[model samples]
Target: MSLKGVELQIAIPKTFDAGKMADQHHQKTINQQLDANEALNREIERKQLAVNKSEGMDAISEEDENDASNNGQTSSEQNKKKKQQQEQDAQHPFKGNLFDFSG
Candidate 1:
């Protein structure tokens, strides 16, 4: 029995192109990230608009208070108290001078 003239066949592994698969995966993730960013931006804009609206309402209320104060004596009492506090503060300087070594 001689096997010198016989040829043997073996199974070989096929090579796949990994670069294309990686490129496809990266593109999918990038699109998802962009969509999330857009959603976040829209949310931020909505919150900012709400904040602006509330601040406008606060300004209107402050204006109304000012108008009411003009016809009340409480405003004068408040002004006198504020003036007295200012005078007291002026008379007694800040204790921060303790750190000043420059005589």
Candidate 2:
């Protein structure tokens, strides 16, 4: 096959440098994305805080309603009532012995 038929090819590498205009555009895009993400995060945090506050308020209101229904009795009065009930139960023991082994 002599040198009568031959072919040559070459590949040129592209420039990787981004000019000032392209760099500015890229930076603007990045800043916009960051701002949008920050806003979204703030909104999420606000909603979470609102939910927490509402839940706390609901718990407080429920406790208040319970106290109101109990004739405004304080925790001490409720505790005394519970102790009295327990003492009464103890005074009246079970009729049948739980340890009875007879068939």
Candidate 3:
């Protein structure tokens, strides 16, 4: 038997395009990353707004305390306390000269 004049033929199924699949996967990841970043930004903005509101409240409370203090004490008493504190500070010349964390 001679097969010199016969040629063999095989049909293969179509394969997926690896490059297209990779591109699609990359796009999905990028979108997910962008969504995460946006969510983080929103959270940060919310936290900053809360901090600002709290800071405003703190300032109001501090003002109230100042008004209360001013109303509660005489001006001479306040001046006397200030003089005493100044004298105490003068007595402590070596205060804050060294850092101690021995607690």
RMSD for each model, in Å, please? 9.2, 10.8, 8.1
**C-alpha lDDT of residue 63 in model 2:** 58
Candidate 1: Cα lDDT at 88: 72
In order, the Cα lDDT scores of the candidates are 0.68, 0.70, 0.72
How would you encode candidate 2's per-residue C-alpha lDDT over 1-103 as one tens digit per residue? 3332222122112222346568889999999999999999999998877745457787678757766788867889977876886686577465554766696
Indicate whether candidate 1 or candidate 3 has the larger TM-score: 3
lDDT of 1 at 21: 74
Candidate 2's C-alpha runs over 4 A off are 1-18, 52-103
Candidates sorted by lDDT, best first: 3, 2, 1
For residues 9-51, write the lDDT of model 1, one tens digit per residue. 2211111346667788999999999999999999999887774
Please, what are the lDDT tens digits per residue for candidate 3 over residues 1-103? 5334232222121124566678899999999999999999999998877744456787678757765778878889877876886687588667768867797
RMSD of 2: 10.8
User: lDDT of candidate 3 vs native?
Assistant: 0.72
Clashing pairs in 2: none
Q: After TM-score superposition, what is the CA distance of residue 44 in candidate 2 from its true location, in Å?
A: 0.9
Those runs of model 1 whose alpha carbons end farther than 4 Å from true positions after fitting are 1-19, 52-66, 69-103
Q: Which of candidates 1 and 2 reaches a greater TM-score?
A: 1
Candidate 3 TM-score, C-alpha based: 0.43
